[model samples]
Target: GFPGNYTDHTIANAAALLGAGRVVGVHRKAELPNYKVFDEKRYFHPGSRPTVVTVKGFRVGVLICEDIWVPEPVRSARAAGAELLVVINASPYECGKQREREAIARARVTDVGLPMAYVNTVSGQDELVFDGNSFAMDATGEVCMRAPPFVEGLYRVDFVRERGRVVPRSGPVAAELSDEASVYGALVLGVRDYVTKHGFPGVVMGLSGGIDSALTLAIAVDALGPERVHAVMMPSRYTSQMSLDDAADEARQLGVKYSVLSIEDVHRDPRDAGRGVRGAPGGYHGREHPVALPDAAADGLVQQDRTDAADHRQQERDGGRLATLYGDMAGGFAPIKDCSKLLVYRLAAYRNGLGAVIPQRVIDRAPSAELRADQKDSDALPPYEVLDPILAAFIEEDLSVEEIAARGFDRATVGRVLDLVKRNEYKRRQAPPGVRVSRRAFGRDWRYPITNGYRRESR
Candidate 1:
């Protein structure tokens, strides 16, 4: 199949290399999904017929990823005398997608009254992370065998003919992971595969004394080891002593190569230059000035640096007047680019639970960019406790200002946040790719145009 004529086909091959009549079964996916990072309908032609083959005197039905999502294909296979169903998938990871997959598989199994064996691909590709939680379910909708998430291995499930039906024998079932654990695992796997597959020897990143950078450093070290990760603290005149101390402590605790390169010499004080610049007020010169130092440091080491920007901040300031075009927004990859500020703290806490790598003060202190005097995140935007939920409602749930206000938020604040998200489209267009753990991310999932005229009026 070519680009526009692709088919998700499953082929059976014989063990012997020179075996005659090797190809026994072939099945093409009947359903083509076109939602949330999936665009199969744009490239694949939907298959219509069911393909069933015999194996060890039991009739086996073959299906692709989306086939079992609907009832037509599974019902057709059952009508065609299939006693067992085998599904091959490349399902990507979302916070609760494993349970969703099992629920859908159980529906198909119940409809056909046939046991199912599901196999999903594992690895990270670009912004997508495929968690390999392959599983098997009996006809009664009980999971018989399960594979752990974020791992690659082969497991066996025995099946026996019982009273004219193929019953899958119960096997080991790995327990489901908590939301934080699952998301952290996805981020770790995503960073590891992205760096290794792209053939980069290692990664370098800025280490601010903030939760976002601390979490990013921990993720980088976990993914590529401390030897391969380089953490640099580029402090400015406004950088606090607490920030410097915390940054150094993080690197020392993680056992990574650390450096502190002061940008104060090259960075002219806005007040000293007498440029008529007032006090630094969350503007580009104040906030993004230090961003360039870390980027430049990565160039010296011949490694790409990761940015610590999260989705909430990016949406609020990136394309607006506050963000410098290439200063803070510049980086090769952003591990938490899709995460909100609230989620960033959650992940940091989760990582520290394993073994306290990130300093407790880093997580406990107020969030700040440390780029300007007495700077704090709340100085620019709404409090994260209030802002993250509004962003999630608008960006992920596509709710209008009124709908969000109905959820007990101030209408004016909701309107303001939504406006910033819409206004920052141009800046987000230039952001680096990051692991997507939500139902929608900035890059491929959210596709609002850069030049749009539509605006929601606040009532």
Candidate 2:
């Protein structure tokens, strides 16, 4: 466990306090994964052997997270006379990830014909949110026990020897969560842990009267109570009266401390020459003036727009001109940065179902930044219905322009979207961290170089 040039080893072991602490047995992880947010091979040396330890006259096999993904480790353990298997994990949460985990566990158990116990950690670590849906399976690949997702608690599973074979007894099994519930739960847990673990007293975010910010505010209050959340509405000349009403209504319904700090005066003042108070290109002064207050005054400032990865793709396509650096993108954490615009609406509707915190008008209103007069998202980019699918094909599925266009999309649109994604790596590099709820996210999931000359043709 030295912190020098040698290397680090990840292991699972059983310990006994014989006078002091005695290491009875150890199982070093044999698989070093290096794909999609995992870079264990960069820092770890893989062990080549399987480990089984005896406890209370029962022989148990020990495995780490990645060790269960492959078959060699489990096969070796069975050959070594292991009666049961226990695998410890810290698997990150993604949509339908629990089903995938159980399927994999079932495959391994059926292969070895032995019961297994799987334990996963629960907590938010940076962008990764680990859902602790730990489980125990019988020899026939049936789940005997399952802990609830997004909850932290100790669970029990009992195994008894029957017909000279170890089998897990039937126990309570938690039901699976729907896609929206699971993603929303991940966002709430991610925000709560990021704030509390970093010792922030509270969170302050801009309330723009848009669905994204409304969803973020609801999540903030749910994570840290209404008392710890502060919502500020900084309206500009271009901001609509409907937006003002919706923002105030959202704050009032949530019972959070709210304020209205208009930036029209600051935008018009001529004496403030040295404070970088100049209008940006396109005559949009909205983004610059409003972010200054929360950036300096709040304990933690969260950017709501960056929650939609599809929006980020469009922002990149605008040559990073739409959102000001350190202005709209300034924040400590972005709860839904991995979500798409379509997913944002789905989550908004989902949150509203569980008590109706966000106003109905907010959900029904057309999406906009309201920076310029009469601005709509479709004015700058394709409709989210069209854009999100293209972005997903390129970012998550790694499909080519031709492949995406073959799916009844405009070839030119697919090409343009892919080009924008390629061009905007620098902007995404500077955006704040957020919960990862997809198979691929912006931060560690997508790692395109800033200066690259690769291009794919739509034709």
Candidate 3:
């Protein structure tokens, strides 16, 4: 592999300085990959050749992340008398990525007729979460050992020579996490690391009585503990009493500090108050009442930062139109912003299972922005049950409108949903960074030109 500048020269110099011997390295490929989610071509020149070396009395093959996905590299390694395969990876985490890794490793080992040990990095870098699901597979394409996913540790693997052939000795095998569990764990780890590593004192989020906010609050508490998390309820004209009660109940149960700051005065200006979000001003107007705090001072509540409507009204009167939705949207972090509406419900259920924190009604109630009178999410978009899969197909799976419609969705509805997803690319880009759990999240993985004229209808 090319190590940036001076490649083999640097390695040789370092090896000589360290008194090393017999360092074999792969040549850089002539061409690099330039595709979705990858811009490798602009980086290092590709390795033009393969290399193998003997390590600890075993002839081992070394391959980088992308090389193992193709067959020719391993074939060349085996041709060079390699008895064992060791792959070093900096693979990013995606849905079912570990399973896919194992499956690919099994295929390579079966092709090369050798035991393989795969190593991967586990770190949450920006929007990318690298799951360390390193593993080893026998020549029979069976996983003999596996390191835990989303955890960092030193794992020891024992290999014994049996009848003049090296075979991986049975070792501790970590059970695969269920899909929901794996995703939930990734979210927790991602949030925990991001908040703590960045040295944020704590986090604050608007605690609407919706599934998205409910799930986000739970994640914040779980990641940084209730003491470091704060929830604010900014109610407006359309806010429901049930929403107020539920939000307060959830805050109390989670032991996170919360406050209710009514936006009633701000909502007096129907033009700005009717719409409660960033776009389409006057499209929504909602409010929720607050409950008395158990002990705001003791909970480390910052009084000056309270979601007081008077301050917002003053700011708005001073030509600060953005202040209208600031109380509801302003936050250091947002956990469920990346999550779809349906996924929000699923995550709420998942968190409650750990311990019933989110109220059942929050999960069961119809989702509404409460921006306008009697406005529900259904008023603006298709039902999440129908919309999520369609969105996933269009965005994640890259399915065309017809392809998605062929999966039992109405063509017109799929077309509409696709249009919404495409039109919202800019909004998603502007959203706060959250955990990336899906195969293709709205963050780094879902890059599309916001001003593009391309339409799925042509396909």
Candidate 4:
């Protein structure tokens, strides 16, 4: 059958590396570990046989990544008189996959008396990282070569049997990197691939000069190059001189376009609009009605009205101000919209980097939303050290107030914390979408009411 006309027909180009030949075999992805990370079943039909290859010299057969983890794939390939086995893969990296693969491949090769070439793709997608450590072995079951770890590389081996030397000639090993190095590498790789794959012109975001923005700027610069990154410092009246300064420093360090546009005026305009927001009848604020209150009726009657004040204030509240309202608009993308204060700082520390790019001052300061006069995040929420863990418990762990209190937190504090969380549902609902890094994120795992009579669980 013609390649394009085959539906549910799987075929491998057995002759891609060989002469003109074809191996028409139906093989589907074997594993669908659809947990938090993988989605293979949704995309592929399970490969029927592990190693069915098109007739080619060397009796070569193929196995997918997970298929070779078991015996059937290798057994079938060997039964077919395959002298050399090639396993193409999108194997996810867990701890020590190389060592595990060595053991698994050794078992497969020894049982079959066949040389195996393990070719794993190298890159990051989602939480999974593909460390391209593609390797090979000899028919005598000796490892011919080991590819470098966590990289993109092509390793070719000259299999010599007539000469009787299975010795491997190797290429450069991309040096082993630290866990931080590995994670950082993964983020950069994922960012680059995603942006390029999605056909984005480039990325634009706030360069808050704090850790999160600093790290983000560094990442963006690394991912798309400095020329492609546009960084803005959309400061409010409360934006400390340090914040403004540090954001500038980050943009400089990352070599991206940087600018500051104060949102103080923007902030004030919104606080002023709190009048409309408050009095708008039924918007977010306003008087609660029974079946019908005049105020409630008035609130729902929002016309196709556009207030420069309203747009400006909504922009400040909804994050459009950082671009549209504030005009420090970097480009068309935003990264750290609702990230907690702690991560923001940690990211800054990360940006300090292998070199001292981010300033220590950014790391050592208290975090603030800086949207109002004399403001700090602590003004509205508890300090992150105190607030973050509690948020983790209440939001992520789903611990009741009593359980949270039991963890050495004051009962009063716990009660207040829960109240704040419930109260802030409106803000969280209105806030810009933030990248999720927690076991649970506010946007998805939670659905609560803005108007309710239910008090604390204890009550």
**Using alpha carbons, what is the TM-score of model 1?**
0.90
Off by over 4 Å in 1: 1-21, 269-287, 303-324, 454-459
lDDT of 1 by residue, 322-389 (tens): 34445556667777777777788888899999999888988889877766787777777788878888
* Winner on TM-score (1 vs 2): 1
Tens digits of per-residue lDDT, candidate 2, 354-458, equal 999888888888888776679876776788799889888888899988899999999987787777777667777887788889898788878788884665554
Candidate 2 colliding pairs: none
Provide the clash count, candidate 4: 12
Kindly list the per-residue Cα lDDT of model 4 for residues 1-459, writing each as its tens digit: 111222546432221233455435534444434433444455444545444554433456766676677787678777876666777777655434466777888888878777788888876553345767778866555677767765686677654444532233443333445444544555566556556755655665555555555666776777688886666566544457777778887788768766665544534443555566656533332111111121121122212111000010111122111222222221222334334455455545565666777678767766544444454546555556877677668766789988998898878777777776665555545443333334445444356676778655532
Positional deviation of 401 in candidate 2, in angstroms? 0.8
Best by TM-score: 1
Q: Candidate 3 lDDT, tens digit per residue, 1-459?
A: 235445343221011111146445443333344654567766555655565666677887767777778788888878988888877777877778898888888888888789998989887765567889888889999888899988899998887778887899888899998776777777777777777777666676667687667777777777678988777776766778998999999999999888887656644654444464645554333232111111232123444543211110110111111122233333444444445666666667777888999899888888776665676767666776887787778767889888988999998888766665665555444445656677766656566787866655532
RMSD of each: 4.0, 4.8, 7.1, 9.4
**TM-score for each of the candidates:** 0.90, 0.88, 0.82, 0.62
Model 2, clash count? 0
C-alpha-based local distance difference test score of model 3: 0.66
The lDDT values for all models are 0.78, 0.77, 0.66, 0.54
Best-to-worst order by TM-score is: 1, 2, 3, 4
